[model samples]
Target chain A: MGKRVGIEVSIAIADAVKLARADVIAAYPITPQTHIVEHLSEIVANGELDAEFITVESEHAAMSCCCGSSAAGARTYTATSSQGLALMSEILYHPGPMRLPIVMTVANRALAAPISIWNDHQDIMAQRDIGWIQTFAENGQEAVDLTLHAFRVAEDRKVSLPMIVNIDGFTLSHVIEPIVIPDQEEVDAYLPAFKPRVRLDVKKPVTMGPVGIPEVYTEAKMAHNEAIKASKRVILQGWKEFAEIFGREYNPVETYRSEDAEVLLVTMGSISETAMSAVDAMRDKGASVGLVRIRLWRPFPGPEFRKAAGKASVLAVIDRCLPPGAVCGPVGAELRSLFYKMPGAPKIFSFVAGLGGRDVTVERFEEIVDKARAYAKKRPTELYEVIGVREI
Target chain B: MAQIDAIVGWKDLPFGCHVYEPGSTAKFRTGDWRSQRPVLDKEKCIKCGMCWVFCPDMCYSQTEEGYFEANMEYCKGCGICAHECPKDAITMVPEED
Candidate 1:
């Protein structure tokens, strides 16, 4: 195990990318996510990392450059936040179907309208169905670990799908933490050189992103859909291998003292750490409460999630994003539909919290559990409740 | 005549539906979608190559006699060549008649 050193999460993520030895870094700096690519650029300038860091004009251009370099058989890396991710949304859908295994870090932040730059799931949830493999980091170490894991799984020949590692903006990105920086030899053994399954070449050329006419459009989308769904296997295998090489092990759904709990608190991103502390507090008070932290977001980890939250009588689910005019937040709706008609299913109480970087403190978690328990007995008329919003 | 008539199902598509063969467009004849064909009048032809330079599909090429001829296989008959001809050397006519 390498020595754990104190470093900002963004810098740690950049070092992780360097350890992976990315061939190209194309990105437009955005708030919160800026430090990640900023460090990357400096590394390239100092000859510490032999990579081309293309400073693109806009997020759209950044993603466009990523597509081009990745298609030309280069291991690509980039980072973006809320609006930056929103801008890259258009071209973001390309890399997955094209099978260019580009790894990106998203400093999760709230979207604009009210113009707040803080940590939230709103940014990532907005682009939720972009067809890239997405995973959440509960803290700085997970942020660093997931960055390396993203590269490994994404570049797997059978699972050549782009991946996004979502780290909470100020919570994880800006915070300083003691993280074990793996040795260069260790990372090299863990993640080998990228070998593109199909790449653009002059001598023997292949036309990528050709016009998909009505004849083949449906079939083309189906193939991409199947490939991404199949990538779940490789995603799990990646963490397993990482544990063998490194000491830490990661899972799709992580549990905390929920073995015999009656109520479970569900959360994602960095706040999951807070939820764990709250679970410990609840257990001290003789409350049958546990916590479930979902690490894998895209493939949804249906089987593992069901196994973790199945025994609970109530699930106090927290979502940082509030999708306006919708029945419930994204995570809420997913669970509702997942357990919709199952026999003896747990009553799920969806609560949207921590919007615009408001802290989901341990106290707030206890409140969510109390509400979930109350609502379990008498269901609330509202589809989901947005907690911590002050009302007159 | 080279249009791809037989489209494969989902299971049979090449990975990402990528075309492995270079210049695979050569096998596709888009002319079938055209309603009109370009008629070149050699009598008025000055070989200025305006038609060759203006064709959207690059269908016009200079023949051995220094006259531009349209390769009917790929032309969609958009009439940019006929419209841009300096000497009125090219005109579009209904393909049916």
Candidate 2:
């Protein structure tokens, strides 16, 4: 094992950008996410990383610049969070459909009503259907590792879906931890420079984003769907390759103490750490429980998730945001579709928790599990349960 | 009016407005002209008037709630209404040639 060193998550991301040898970077400043671009800017300015770092007026333009650069066959990167991400939501779907492998770092932050700048999954969760490969890192080290691997996974010919690597705002982005800075020679050997077979080459004119008629419109969407489905194999392959080089492990879905447990708790992002401690406490008290963390949200690992939650009597899904008038958060809705036909698939209990950066303590996780256990005993009434709210 | 002998040389038409030789490249291929007409879901439409306003050839009639029936006589099946419908109530599917 390598000796551990303390480093902030922002610097870790900058170091990953350097290792990835990103050809072009364009970003706008936003809280929590700002430090990452700032560090990258300094690196570019100091001539440490030879890349075109363009500062744009807004997040939408930032993404637009990425689209142009990636289309020109460059390894592109960017960072944003919260309102910045929401602002760029439209263009986010365009790059993937065009099959440009642009990697981005989103410092996960809470959405606004009054306004907030704290850590939450609401921003990235809202972008679930944007056709991007999404991953959540629990800490700074994972953030750097995943960000580097995202480029490799995305540019793979089998899976040309763009990827978003998410680290919690302030929590992971500003925090420090030991990150193994991979040697440039090693990274160059691991992640070869992007050489697109198809690009916007003026020598050979080809159409892109053309208005397709009925004869071809559905075909375009179907192609994108199939490409994403194909990405599953690419993700596993990328993980295997990354492990071979770095000796670090990664999976689409991660389980902690999940074996021989009747009850399982599901969550994502930074809250998994909290959930783990809660599961440990519950186990110490002789409770039959475990935790399953969903690392990849998009290209949702339905089959893998089913295998992970095998034979559990009750599956409690915890989400950080509400879908308002819907049965549960988006994650719960996606999970429910996976087991609609299976017999004895276990009763799924959806719980909404940790909105607007609220503290999700160990006691709260246990309370959610207890409520879910009670509900599973009765006839299923509703598909969702709102946790940690005072009902009048 | 003077002497209606024969309407020849009109076969060089492009949009069926004229006539031309069968094998000529300038002649229209009727096979390519057939395409799907746009269908509107009136129930989900919110009187946005976007479809009517955005029709490139003004083929859509403005109804009180939304655009009225598409005029197939002039409708080229361009699908501008389908693309511009913000509510996604308009759909275009293939029609028999």
Candidate 3:
């Protein structure tokens, strides 16, 4: 057991990486994600952590370096946000099929055209199909816990995939919160030393990332797809082991007051906490409303999500990112596709609420619920509704 | 056809972007794609090793008597060896196919 200390979430994440005993860290500085790698550099410089801290010139190079390090059988890590993540996109798709279990932290931030450094899901949402296992943390504590869990799941022999833990940019990354910083011994017990099933070694050389001609390309992709899907079991196992050791339970799709509710608000990332507060307020007003937070995004946990939201009559899916020109926002569109063929599926109302760090207050959530109820009562209309946009 | 059949099933292929054997490109036999081949004139050879250095595929190797010869197993007959040979000991000729 370790003492509960109040620290910034970025520092807590750096501490988690240190506890996990990552062997290599290659990162480029970017807003909101800078503090995490800065603290990690300090730890490495102070000799508290024995790791190779590479200060790369760009996010592209940082991810490339991480790929090289992880392929060389070193437990590797990196952190980025917004444009840094976008810049790394070129090399981001390499680690998954290469089966390098490198863990990264993504401080979710808004993409720039007008250039705002703030919290949003647009950054991570744009990278949804890169073949990495993705998870969202609603608060600072989960950010710390999931950082540790990301390594455990990624390094599992069955999973052998890369993973990203997304924490909302200024909201969760810069905020101070009380978190339990687990001791090294407990973390060592929970996450064993990473033993790569295959690696680049001089004594036993093996070719990795070889060109896949057309004959084998589809098979290669199929193998990568099946690996990520099968990783759901390993993820659950890691969370189960984490609960036994830390006494904090986690699920792929976690529900709040959704056991008996007619209207459900679905959210990911830090907005889930605010949505939960809104759920409490609505419950006080004798409204059967609840919250469903998607903690795991990749390999989507479709069965778990279906079971959790199946009983609801009306589902309001609040998307933080605006998928322009699409029928609905990204998360909402995904949910619609998932529930379209489902038996007795709830009437899903897609709402794009927060974009570019726009505040999604409890009042906004209440309004979302009201609009969903209204749409459910009326005839079926548009596929999605963009809320909070001022008429200009 | 047997080789193609072996890889048609998912179980036969290596999992997840792997090349199970190191240096397995040797088995590809790129010489089959060659249209022009470099013939070495051993009588006029000075063995400056320029052909070996300039070979795009590095297919030229030193012989026991210190003369350069193409391995032909992986050479694509690019003719860089013939073009770059300082001693004029190599000439590119059309292959019989």
Give the poorly placed runs of model 1, Cα more than 4 Å off: B1-3, B26-55, B58-97
Tens digits of per-residue lDDT for model 2, A157-250: 7676689998988888988777777777768777988987567777765555544344344556666777788798988888899899888999
List the candidate 2 regions with Cα displacement exceeding 4 Å: A1-3, A379-381, B1-97
DockQ of every predicted complex:
0.43, 0.03, 0.39
Clashes of each: 0, 6, 0
Question: Model 1, residue A300: displacement in angstroms?
Answer: 1.9
lDDT of 1 at A134: 96
Which of the two candidates, 1 or 3, achieves a greater DockQ against the reference?
Answer: 1
Tell the DockQ for candidate 2.
Answer: 0.03
Cα RMSD (Å) per model? 3.1, 12.3, 3.8
Please provide TM-scores computed only on chain A for all of the candidate models, following their numbering.
0.99, 0.97, 0.99
Candidate 2 share of real interface contacts: 0.00
Residue pairs clashing, model 1: none
Share of native interface contacts recovered by each model = 0.69, 0.00, 0.62
| Candidate 3 displacement at residue B90 in angstroms | 13
TM-score of each: 0.90, 0.80, 0.88
